[model samples]
Target: MIDVGLLLTMIVAVGVPSLVARWWPLTTFGEPVGFLDVAIWPAMVGLGVGRLVAVALDGPSSLGSLSDLLIIRSGVEFWPGVAAAMLAAAWSAHRSGVASFDRLADLVPLALIGYAGYEATCLVRDGCYGPETSLGIRPPGTSTTMLPVGILAAIAVVVGAVVLHRQLGRRASWAVVMGGLTVVAGVRSLAAIWLPHIGDGLTRQHWSSIAVLLATVPALTAGVLGGHPATRERQLLDR
Candidate 1:
């Protein structure tokens, strides 16, 4: 069982800064750097390392086993997903011509908040709660008591959307929202791996999950790149 209080605390820690950014946006005297720019790489690096380690030691098959699922559900996958999405979103923002890195720094705090919230959801769902353990505190109906990584990812999404909104305007906000939903769908699709034998079967469920991930990579890239400052500035200047 995971400690709900600690899980919530983690979410708050990551999330509040982003909300604060909305009000007291980060600034170097007066420049704005989007929230995604700051938080994306760090979150991604953390997630990439965790996933790489798990895959290296246990293989992909260990990803959705009951024990593994507990970990995933606990938000183990949150940071990686946030990292990937943030990178993708940042690239999209840069390409969109919405704002420069200097102008966007203020947005990082908000994105962190969203990532935290997302991970908290995972903790409640027991997605990555880990196996039974005798150490630390455990929540009811769970073996291990650890914070989920998804909370951080969710915080990223929330904050990312705000940053996109601030930089790219409403259109980018919509894109962020859509992209976030797609990621959720992809996660759900992958979650089927937890189902007994369903994951073992060669079917669309697995393929769909892979497809979503594959699709997300390019879509996110394009979104970020397409939203670059030079491009948007030109578009605005033209209009």
Candidate 2:
């Protein structure tokens, strides 16, 4: 039987943007229907790429045939899927004449909240987990040590979204949330440090997290300086 929890995770992750956008007050950057439009193709691409990357990373032992490789539902990585999807969505949005950055700005809060939903779903489904240790309280239902990171990740996102919502709606302020996520990545890495599964070496995400932190400095700085003045009119009245 198909895993109901996993199915729910996918649905919530994809449907979140639409749910959030449905009641949004007027804006120049996004249409109520635009989130799904921006998301659909990229989601397809992300799933394909994420599954392929998993196949490659897992090595030849797992794959008996090309047909097995085509099956994406069994394995997927969030970072690869998200990265690929974001790029695809960005390109697609640009091609479709949507204001890319502005839409992305609009997406930050929704994405953060959406991701929290993903983290919550992970509690029920086997998903991104951290090291085994007593440092953090175990998730209520699962014995997994990873829930702390998910909790922290959710907290960081919510905090960033709250912070951003108070801003004058500068597109650059969205980077502040990016920076917050970068910080969460570091927190996850630190949590993994005590994990037996990870060992002594820094994982790929650790390196990527550092890279994000490095990028975040400038992005946050630029946000503070006022980003893309052309977007000034799109601002939702400074609060």
Candidate 3:
């Protein structure tokens, strides 16, 4: 069973993003805007809040639990923070006259980088452990394989974005990057679903997978509509 505090944290993480989308009228990457646009800040804040909560609940040992591997999944706690971040980001983009979706597309790489960084920090601070196996490779003092994977993913996202940006132009490249992210995220979810019991700790990959799929619907939608002159014309009139 998941710890009550951890459960609460997960719930908040999932809920925040949905609430932001419902509350704010914005779109991300040509998709109907939801919590992702505003997710950055709230996620950051949540990290802090989560840490404090952990300290209060378990003292310094909480840091060791950071490396405990879990599937990236969404829950009530995570989404709300994501939604808040998305809301803020969308509003800022709208006010600046940048296409909210387009802006978000460009920022996706950076966002991933930040997220990975956070995960790495958590691994160090919490000292979580992964499964023990003959094939397992542990970093200096940690017990999980997540650190390397996290770093690799982060590098891939950032490098891909940079290369795509240079070759395809910002808007097109961002769309491609985000589209790829959506696909990778989806595949990861599927793997989690199939394996179900592979990761060491409580896996949230299930929630993350669902959220990514949901988010992709809007992203693809926006990409399609954005290219239509009629949509642009309608948007101009609405503005």
* lDDT by residue for model 2 (1-239), tens: 77787789878776765676675432534444555655678778878778777777776665667888876666665567767866776676587687665555555556666666676566666554555566655655566654356656656666765565545254453664564455445545555554335457776656665665676667677766776655665585553
- The model with the greatest lDDT is 2
Q: Which stretches of model 3 miss by more than 4 angstroms? A: 1-76, 128-131, 135-156, 163-177, 180-205, 214-239
Q: Which stretches of model 1 miss by more than 4 angstroms?
A: 1-128, 131-137, 145-147, 150-152, 170-209, 229-239
Q: Is candidate 1 or candidate 3 better by lDDT?
A: 1
What does the lDDT read for residue 111 in candidate 1? 48
Backbone clash count for every predicted candidate, in the order shown: 71, 0, 50
Best model number under TM-score: 2
RMSD of each: 14.0, 5.3, 11.9
Worst 10 residues of 2 by lDDT: 23-32
Q: What is the per-residue lDDT of model 3 for residues 1-239, given as tens digits with 9 covering 90 to 100?
A: 55554455444434543553353333344566445545555455555444444353444554455542121232123334444555565576788688765666554544544443443332343332334445534655654453234334434544543443343232353455456556446544544443325467546546766777788757755754556445567799999
Of the two candidates 2 and 3, the one with more favorable lDDT, higher being better, is 2
| Candidate 2: residue pairs that collide | none
Tally clashing residue pairs in candidate 1: 71
lDDT of each: 0.51, 0.62, 0.48
TM-scores of all predicted structures:
0.35, 0.71, 0.45
Candidate 1 has what TM-score? 0.35
